[model samples]
Target chain A: MELTLHVWRQKNGQDSGKMVTYKARDVAPESSFLEMLDQVNEDLIKQNDEPIAFDHDCREGICGSCSMMINGKAHGGRKGTTTCQLHMRSFKDGEQIYIEPWRAKAFPVVKDLVVDRGAFDRIISSGGFVSVNTGGVPDANAILISKQSADTAMDAAECIGCGACVAACKNASSMLFVAAKVSQFANLPQGQPERMQRVSNMVEQMDKEGFGNCTNYFECEAACPKQISVGFIANMNRDYLKASLLHQEPVGKA
Target chain B: MSWIVRLQKSSLGSKYIMAITGAGLFVFLIGHIAGNLLLYFGQEAMNAYALSLHHLPYGLLWVARGGLLVFALAHVFIAYRLSFHNRAARPQRYQYEATLQASFASRTMPYTGTLVLLFILFHLAQFTFHLVAYNGPYTDSLGRDDVYTMVVNAFQNPVYSVLYIISMLVIGFHLSHGLSSMWQSLGLNHQKYNLLFRKLSPLAGWVLCLAAASIPLAVLVGVIK
Candidate 1:
């Protein structure tokens, strides 16, 4: 099958980018979207040109490494699937696919179809982890979490740090992503020590990052491979509001 | 700290402001429509309505009007800034087509707002200030050329009534997303309120739309004349 690709190409973080059209031939209908890109890269190598760069690893989609904006969607037109999981069968023969990187002011383009998602990392570092000592594993029953709490925690923990939520949001807001990280710990007893601090600091960090605000589009949920609910966003909001209200800065108003 | 500065400068801040201002606007629209509803009774009744408002003690009227002005300015400023920022971030329309898959009102706020802004200006000129040179006769709250009666006489013109009705339809379009967006901005995240606001916003929007649109339709059709 033949495919017309409108692939974004950027030299580096400093340079502006443009969409370059490439005619890819002999694509296999059974091949995944990454496989089709591999074919195109091979052709580029034969022509002694720099292959279009993109991000993918563990092609199985669990690592949250495979990222691309196929057409207008975050991980292509398919729902609940990553780019590497999307197969050519989803596209018609002779189809034109628009591919680009995860876009947000925080996630600057590091290279073609690759963005610096370090903002998300900073958000996590601010408070995405439990304060349990890492010297040795604690007893399994040290904290007897209710079945419901454990289940809800697991649901929030399913987030893979992909920037799809930010990409899908009209404002490029990462509320869903930040909310998931906050909810995972805040829901469990192990995370109680830093619960208030975690929500406050992480939300502050998220704001420091260039991500936009959530506008209730629900596009983030629709685009998210894990389908993290917007409920967590509400939880984060409640916690943050409480924290800010209680811990007023000594100086000027927040 | 600079971190706080950076946070507020981000796109998220604009959306927050949008949601907050939108909520205030939604509340204001309801009151405005309710006030307009008096036109249904008769000229004397509507004029008394305006007179009642003017009779408020202290600086209350000035405060309300001042607050409204601030809200309108901030809302329009924030919306324009956000839209421009969104455009700059994209720099180009999507190569592939995408649909909103939402209500018609949800889809056209940006465009409808532009029209509504013009309509608002015309509205202020025609009725608020009596500066539009409209030949229609209007009786005031104290039985003078009050703006409320101008509202009635203007609606008597089918053309004016249709314009008002169409503009209200646009307002409905604006409200649909505006209300939800505001709830989100206020950070009202409890699932109970989330469901409550979702149900409440659309109903409120529809009520305002119906009430506002009904006035002109009634007068134009001679139901209220």
Candidate 2:
């Protein structure tokens, strides 16, 4: 199916971008959205023009590198799906799709449809890790976490750090992302030692980095490819508030 | 401004004021609904109900009015403070944008809230002012004074009922997210009530919507006719 695309293009980080329309003919319905994009890049290269640059790696959808705002909805109107996982079949003939990068102060656009999710890395670095050695991976039964507990932890860990939560949030908050990372570590005994410092540092870092407070909109949950629940954000709030109240300033931003 | 968010994070006073004031507003909704239902009680019953409110002891009467005034002002003040902090935390708005993606109620909050504010001002002017609209204390046929009759009379016009119904709907959508959301924001939700809050939140919104809007609808259909 042939489709008209309104894609944002900017020369660099300082360049102001606008929607420049392009046309692609004879696109296959089965092609994944990224592959369809590849077809367009191939055409652009043949014309000696710069191929549109977007984030992608291990296109199987695990890396969380593929981020784009397709049409008005994040990840192109699919529930629990990533942009790489989205297929052309979701589009119709003669449809004009608006493609842009994730919009947030923290996740600024690096180029067209590509944003720097490094702020997430910084948040994780703040307090997201378990510093305790735990004696080089003790016996599996040592801590003995229940199946239910492990499953819940896994659910929180399912977050891909894609910044969809930030993009989907009306306040552009990254609480969901920060909370998931904190809970994943805090839920397990292995992360117990640094839990206090971890939460305080992470939360303080999240604010310092310019992310908005979680207003309980729960939009991030709906937009998440992994369907990560916003419940983790509540957990983060509980932990952060406790840390703040306890006057536990983290060990220098961890 | 930053101090407000910090103070809100610091202790129970700030958030409790917000929650208590919010819950007080919730109570007012129930009372408002109860009084509005009096419209279906016919002119006499409605008039008697309104009159009884004024006949209460002076201390009690003043206390109730003062409480409502405090609750309304506090709710708006906290809302404005929260909105201001939220703005300070984010970048400027772009014409075309996408978000972590939220429910419809979540997205339209500030707009719905603005409309509700305008409605509230007009509502007070129309219902509270004597010379401009509502005259002196109403009295029932049996010589008992009543104010509810004025309510029924006011709702007699189809235009008024329709406008009231629309505002109720907007209030419904607002409460859908606003009620449980206030709790979640303050960190009151936990494992047991987490799902319960999310599920019941929408139900409560619908109940408020239907209950609040039902009065206007019933009056408009002339069920009292």
Candidate 3:
């Protein structure tokens, strides 16, 4: 199949980017979206032209590294499918595909179809962890967590940190991402000790990173590749409210 | 740090402020609509309801009005703050923007809210302050303030009724998103109640706005003279 591609091109972060058109000829329908791009790049290299640059570590989609807005949609608007997993057959013959990077102040464009998502890492480092002694591995059954709670935790843990939620949100709010990170622990026994502090610290970091607030539109859930639920956001909101208001620990301890 | 200061600084805190104030305003809307429905019961009943509100002791009516003003101001103020913050978050927009899930009402909250606020100001001028051309220090047969006649005279004008009906539609549009948003912002979501909670916004929005609009429609049709 032949396809026309409008890809974003940028020299560096300092250089303002623009869309550049390219042609993908002799592309196989069975080939993945990334493979089609690779073929296009190979042709560009043979012609002594700059190739489009994007991020993709694991083509399997678990690494959440392959981030791009295809046709103005995160991960090509496929249900639970990443760009690397999307096939060329998803489009018709001779279709024009518009590919761009995620748009967010927190996620700046690094190059063609690549945006920096280091803000997510900062949010995680702030509180997205459980403090535990490294003396020994505890028995999994020792905690005696309910099956329902375990299921909730596991569901929330499916988040891949792809920043699609940020990209799709009109406000560019990372609430859904932060909510997933917060809820994965909030639903478990081991997450009990630092529940209050975790939400407070992580939320503070998220605010400092200049992400917008969630207005309950649920756009993040729709864009999420892992199909993360907005219920986590409500859990985070509940926990944050309690943490900030009712559970204020003493000055030095907190 | 004080929780008050903390609430002022955080994003979730901002949502809480909006939810709490929005919930208050929503309750006031319910009461306002309920009171206005008295117009359907004839002029005497409507005038009596107005008189009862005026007869409250210790200037309680004034206190209620003041509280509503505070809620409206806070709701609008935080809305602006959040809008600016949201706009700044996406300094550069997508060239080919597409919305997959957000409703028309959810996306247009600020515009609808601004329209509602303007309507409220105009409504106050026309009715509450009696500053419009139909100003009435009117007295009924019982020597009471004839609020019923004032309302009837106002809605009888085709221009006034049309403006009122349009304003009601806008208010309904605003509440369709806002009522549901309040529950989520307050951390009140559950799987069992989620469906009901989601339906509550649009259902309540239409019901309340239509109920309020009914009075003007009835007056225009000469049913409440």
Fnat of every candidate, listed in order: 0.25, 0.37, 0.75
Give the winner by TM-score. Answer: 3
**TM-score (second chain) of model 2:** 0.82
Off by over 4 Å in 1: A134-137, A248-254, B1-20, B57-59, B77-94, B97-118, B140-148, B157-159, B189-195
- lDDT, model 2: 0.76
Give per-candidate clash totals. 5, 15, 0
Instruction: Return the candidate ranking by DockQ, descending.
Output: 3, 1, 2
Please tell me which predicted candidate would have the highest lDDT against the true structure. 3
Q: Per-candidate RMSD vs. true structure?
A: 3.8, 4.6, 1.8
Error of 2 at A149 (Å): 1.3
lDDT of candidates 1 onward, in order:
0.78, 0.76, 0.91
List of clashing residue pairs for candidate 1: A173-A212, A213-B12, B47-B141, B140-B144, B140-B146
lDDT of 1 by residue, A1-254 (tens): 99999999999998888999999899989999999999999999999999998888898878898787888788885877999999999999999889988777888888999988899899999998876556887777877999999999999999999888877766677889998999998899888878888987887787677566554667787889888887787677767656654655458757
lDDT of 3 by residue, A1-254 (tens): 99999988988899988988999999999999999999999999999998889999989989899998888889988889989999999999999999889989999888888889999999999999999898888886787988999999999999999999999998999999999999999999889999999999999999999999898998888889999999899999999999887875577943
Error of 2 at B214 (Å): 4.1
lDDT of 1 by residue, B91-172 (tens): 3344553432334555455677778788889888877776774766655545565655566678788888898889888877
Question: Considering TM-score, where higher is better, how would the candidates rank from best to worst?
Answer: 3, 1, 2
Better of 2 and 3 by TM-score: 3
